[model samples]
Target: MTDRILLTCGEPAGIGPELAPLALESGVDFVWIGDPRHLPEGTAYHEVVAPSDPVPEGRLPVLPHDFAAPATPGRPDPANAPDVIEVIARAVDLIMRGESRAMTTLPISKQALKEGAGFGFPGHTEYLADLAGGVPVAMMLASTTVTPPCRVVPATIHIPLSQVPDALTDRVLEQAIRITHAALIRDFGIAAPRIAVAGLNPHAGEGGTIGHEEIRRFRPLLDRLRAEGMQIAGPLPADTMFHPPARSRYDAAICAYHDQALIPIKTLDFAGGVNVTLGLPFIRTSPDHGTAFDIAGQGRADPASTIAALRMARDMAANRA
Candidate 1:
């Protein structure tokens, strides 16, 4: 076990491999776990026997895992899908064993993994949750550069907008709120976290004119949590909850849907946003964006989010149990 963070190189065919060399600019102590061959040609790297090995300056420390095939820019090899899945599991094992202080994952293509390797999980969050004994978790996108950092958690994710009404049960919203609240205190070191809840419809149902979900279920849920001494505000209109004044009123915003939460933060800090999974046993953070197959091998891939993810992971790990 080492004090450094263990980074998993996700989707070799994507820009994940190339970003490692660029993320080094953040100067956070971390080692990458992936096939060295997948890295951009002419990259400086050294193979380490264990995760605890110290990395030399100007070189990436690779805990190598060979893939079934070579990676091509802008294209994923289904033949290497199982290998990609294995790398994530291996990284999980290292972290669970306390071999690293935290974990930072690059982006991955769920389609490729599912079609090639029969991946059953929805995405990294679900798979990681299953791996950690089916513990409940929430996805939070946290801005790294904003004046008052913007943090958001979408109660319902990866589901169609029409399906949101049926999917976002009182149980789901309550769990997301509990997880986000606990994580704000545990991982972020906030003594009294104020969570702002966003409504499911415009104008927060306009007092039941636009929609009833806000008045029917949302308000009741917030009332319960507030009675427990939680500083909760809203079932407010999602439209007006993200402006500077609204943002300053809460530590994190719990939105009704994915776009409601992500659109505001991604618009606020595109490059410096980091995706954090709340309620996980081990610390995990990732770049808010996905695999940029369009610029895989090109030198145009920016490392801002990756660096932010690393720094955020370090900060969270320092506050862990």
Candidate 2:
């Protein structure tokens, strides 16, 4: 397999086009997989037949995937949505076949994909899992700039907060921990990963005064995981777990839900957070932000997260190799 990273172009109408130029600043070996027509006017790009093809100096190597129509800034064309989905699939196929070692995905608009192409999956993570034969995976938002590099996994993600109580089961939490622990070893080179688990209710159910899921459901599971000799701590209160002193205790935190895991890392290093998918056969990562429709073509999109994602993916690919 070629030591190349495939970057799938996301929603054409979003900042993916302009951000492509910014991604070049990352200084990693990656080829863009999208329609050249969707790229910003005057952006220098080289058309390569495959990821293994040699790239010349200063030109972005592009493995062009044609779209249905030309892009208009900030307004998604439903016609191009199908092609947008196809580009991601193409990248996955390339990676799975060992044409490339890893892929860094640009942000996709789930609403647009659903409305335009009848996309059924909630987001890229779910769709990617299905594409990989329904393997279970967890979403990790990891900091690229933090001292200890705050890595977090949300037990219940993309679902409404109401669903989280029922969804954040021992099974779900244990799977996240196992996947993360294994990934830490296989993809991150961590010999024995330290993990912290967050509590579900306010003050970790306040000794079951507020909620019993933490007492009845989660603790027992955590105890079992601990007995297996994995380095683990807590069912700690989410409110107090991310302070500087607390963050230093573990390599990663398994939080109860989405915001519980995300808020602190975004607070600590907003511009450099990366969204990583754990438990996939191949490496995958993306910027921790979404399509900024308001600034799609304004040249105001921050490339820091995208750059971080590429760097992280490159490092992950190396670690696997």
Candidate 3:
């Protein structure tokens, strides 16, 4: 596996710039794509012409892209939004061209990008899917650095609570499960990964008292997959599925919606969670947390999630190889 990874510096006004320098100390080789001027003052960085250029210890390796305006912490500049998007595109291009093994990203502000550049996608996942020619992908928050090492995939994401039921269709759930299952085998090296499915309502809809989607939609799909020789379980109660004993039963937990999946993992290991995109042509991972604007330039942003993301990206790339 190539030692170099492409790192996109997200929103200049956020903690992304501050985290970049700290991530350099993680012992994972990466070439950061962003404007060096946006980085925290007194940061040590080496400007590199290519992703494969040598990087020295304690110094960030940067592939500079100049922003149109200076970045002030906690105050996003719209003029620099285009450049933020450009860095992500550049990272994607490098990965496609085989210049980098994988891509790890910092948090980006969708609102800032939309207001500035008329960015149309919902978030980075959708934008990346479009970049990869509209491939079907699932976001998996995998916690390898924490005990029990749980991984989760939400069946329906970025939708309102009312729309979650309709969005969690048979096709969508099956696709998410298939992608996650394949990723566990290929990217995580699990020979027979057990996946636990979480029900949408309380007590798994109390067997149809609270809701019927689990009975009408989830069960049939899970049964079909189980018959196909996949190690699948549940339509289980969402409340109890995340306990230690319960988590140990499965390699991954597939939930009905965004919060159902994310809440448990974040509760368990907020700092160490890594957001991995499953079924992408190339590997992509990011820190689970977002761009903390309030803490930007405060010199207090923790790099734990960023470090975990880089390590997970490296491991996934090696597994794919």
Q: Which ten residues in a row have the lowest lDDT in candidate 3?
A: 142-151
lDDT, candidate 3, 109-131, per-residue tens = 99999999999999999899999
Residue-level lDDT of model 2, residues 197-252, one tens digit each, is 99989999999999998889878998998899999988899998888789889889
- Give per-residue lDDT, candidate 3, residue 199: 89
* Collision pairs in model 1: none
**CA lDDT, candidate 3, residue 159:** 89
**Candidate 2 — which pairs collide?**
none
- Residues 1-321, model 1: lDDT tens digits: 576888998999899998998988998888999999999989999999788887778999899999999999889999989998999999888989878868999999999999999999889999888888899999999999997889999999999899999999999999999999999999999989999998888898999999999889988889989999999998988888888888889999998899999999999999999999998899999999889998888888999999999999999988874
Taking every candidate in turn, the Cα RMSD to the unseen true structure, in Å, is: 0.9, 0.9, 1.1
Task: Give candidate 1 regions above 4 Å deviation.
Answer: none
Query: TM-score of every model?
Result: 0.98, 0.98, 0.98
Instruction: Rate residue 120 of model 2 by lDDT.
Output: 97
lDDT of 1 at 72: 94
Residue 63 alpha-carbon offset, candidate 1, angstroms: 0.6
Cα lDDT for residue 305, model 2?
A: 95
Backbone N/Cα/C clashes per model:
0, 0, 0
